[model samples]
Target: MNHSLDGQVAIVTGAARGIGLGIARKLKADGARVAIWDLDVAGCDAQRLGFEADHLQPVDVASYESVERAFGATVEALGRVDILVNNAGINGPVVPSWEYPVDAWQRVLAVDLNSVFYCCRVAIPHMRARGGGRIVNVASIAGKEGVQYISAYSAAKAGVIAFTKSAAKELARDNVLINCVAPAMVETELFREMSDQHIEASKAKIPMGRFLQVDEVGSMVSWIASPACSFTTGFTFDLTGGRATY
Candidate 1:
């Protein structure tokens, strides 16, 4: 499928590496000018990565102030914001719910859930000014079917799913579409934060018998962020390899 985002400008959070980077690469490949937003901006090689030097934004999406600053910078540099990918997140410690530390739980929700709200709050006005836009929030199957050990991650993602739906409805009349992707386990650096047993268990649940690839996520997100995805607002598109039947 040729999902062309020609002449558009996209802001992808946490895009310095892993799945966020994958989404940024695909958006760039599909003809969108991408602004890479991440805390590790110093680690990115703009020339090597094919992103413009001016568009590399060091942003902490969990903070509204930081998100606001980044949004203004992106608009000043890129001219407009057509797509917003709330992809920055952290997989908190993989301990059981009761054993989950209080601070760790709060941190997970701050990054995974609150960051989505913060980014959307900052970008929606700009997108409205631009006439219309697409927003793709990266959620997870854990949100739908709660994961045993990662309660915080699961809860945060569930919040993302709900938030996407509500935001989509509010923007439907304004042509500002919002949707979310509920992907299963993707083999990223996040796996380093999980236990070996949890990893195997997650993989075993996938009918595809494999973890999701980053490019696969990019491909789906590219379509969702494109004009072709019209008529699909407030939806949770599943990328769970059949692990989630709904």
Candidate 2:
């Protein structure tokens, strides 16, 4: 059987670059019209993502008002939303829990965890009104295995995982399937935020002896956000390169 996303409208947060941009490319290639939401819309090339200028918008997912307006604009311009990729996130201060700054910790949770709830809260009503939709949260293997020196990032992602499962149950009968994609390590701009020691250690932990690619993660997300993904919700898909034991 073939999976086609013809006529679908998707919103990919943090899509100005990295994994989010990669996902937008794949989704557009797969026949879905995509909208990018981020703080600065500078890096996004509508031509590169095969979208029009109107599809890109500046949005701070951490702010409820920003999310609501951006989502409303998307529906107004694209017609209706069929998929949402919650990929906006940040890797806060890399320090032991005792040494992590309070502000950094709070910001990480606000962006990485609470933003998911905010985006979902605004998007779910639109989705349910449309009868169905798909939501794929971009979590991390750290959320599951808990990496050292990045306690805030690890905890926020774990919250995302838990929130996904709980939200799935709440929306089970509504036809809006929600799930998570937990990738171990990927080569992207996000790497610049990590220390050399941390990056090398992460790569060493993956049994495949290499980091995952952005396009590979994109492919997983595209499918999960398609009708082909029906019947599975609240599930966590791993892109860990053989490091996941469960």
Predictions: Cα RMSD each:
1.4, 1.3
Clashing pairs in 2: none
TM-score of each: 0.97, 0.97
- TM-score of structure candidate 2: 0.97
- Please write out the lDDT profile of model 1 over residues 1-246, one tens digit for every residue: 437899999999999888999999999988998999998798688675656533899988888999999899889988889999999999988888999999999999999999999999988998898789999999999999989989999999999999999999899989899999999989899889888999999999999999999999999999999999988999999998998988
Regions of model 2 farther than 4 Å from truth: 47-54
lDDT of candidate 1 vs native? 0.91
What is the TM-score (0 to 1) of candidate 1?
0.97
Poorest 10 consecutive residues by lDDT, candidate 1: 46-55
lDDT (Cα atoms) of all candidates against the true structure: 0.91, 0.92
